[model samples]
Target: MKEFNALVVDPVGLHARPATVAVNAASKFKSEIKLSYKGRSVNMKSIMGVMSLGIPTQSEITISAEGEDAEAAVQTIEEVLKTQKVIA
Candidate 1:
């Protein structure tokens, strides 16, 4: 598994918009993507799962992936999070 910590850069936090972006990006890969904040973890490919985390702005979260494409999935997601200004 590969993991990285990202800080929510969006003012609105991990709400529907950025969470949808993450789900869309994560669904394209075969890896199992997990996002964790505080003490809870959720499937990154599920919009509801992500938004339910209630991640607020400036909060830190960890994104991890496991499976054949774990590296690609983690890297792409990290980049997407930064590029999309959802996380930094």
Candidate 2:
């Protein structure tokens, strides 16, 4: 498994837009991706799961991926987070 933490930068936190962006990218990969915030964890490929976390702005969340494309999946997801200003 590979894991990395990203700080949410968007003013609205990890809301619908970022959740959609993340889930869209995550679903393309074979790797199993999970996102954790505080004490709650959810599947990255599911939009509801991510949005349900209610991650606030400036909060740090850890993303973990495990599988053949874990590294690439993490990199791709990280890029989206950065592009969406959801993570820094």
Candidate 3:
């Protein structure tokens, strides 16, 4: 598995827009990607799963992927999160 932690910087936290962006990004990968916040973890490709976390600003989130494209998946998600200003 490949993973990285990021601090959410968005004032609204991981809301619909950014969550959709993340889900869209994760869906492009074949690997199993997950986003973790607090003690909960959910599939990164699932919009409902991601939004259920209710992640807030300054919260630390861990994104992980397992399978052939694990590294690439994590990297892509990191880039997406950064570009969306969801994490810095």
Highest-lDDT candidate: 3
Worst 10 residues of 3 by lDDT: 13-22
Expressed as tens digits, the lDDT of each residue in 11-52 for candidate 3 is 999899988998999999999999999889999999999999
Q: What lDDT does the true structure give each of the candidates?
A: 0.90, 0.92, 0.95
> Which pairs clash in model 1?
none
Give the alpha carbon lDDT tens digit for every residue of 1-88 in model 1: 9999988988988788767877899999999999999999999998888988899999999999999999999999898888779886
Candidate 3 ranges with C-alpha deviation above 4 Å: none
lDDT-better candidate, 1 vs 3: 3
Model 3, residue 67: displacement in angstroms?
0.3
Tens-digit lDDT track of model 2 for 2-88: 889988888899999778988999999999999999988999999989988999999989999999999999999999899988888
In model 2, which residue pairs have backbone atoms overlapping below 3 Å?
none
Instruction: Provide the global lDDT of candidate 1 against the true structure.
Output: 0.90
Q: What is the lDDT of residue 82 in candidate 2?
A: 91
Q: Model 1 shows how many backbone clashes?
A: 0
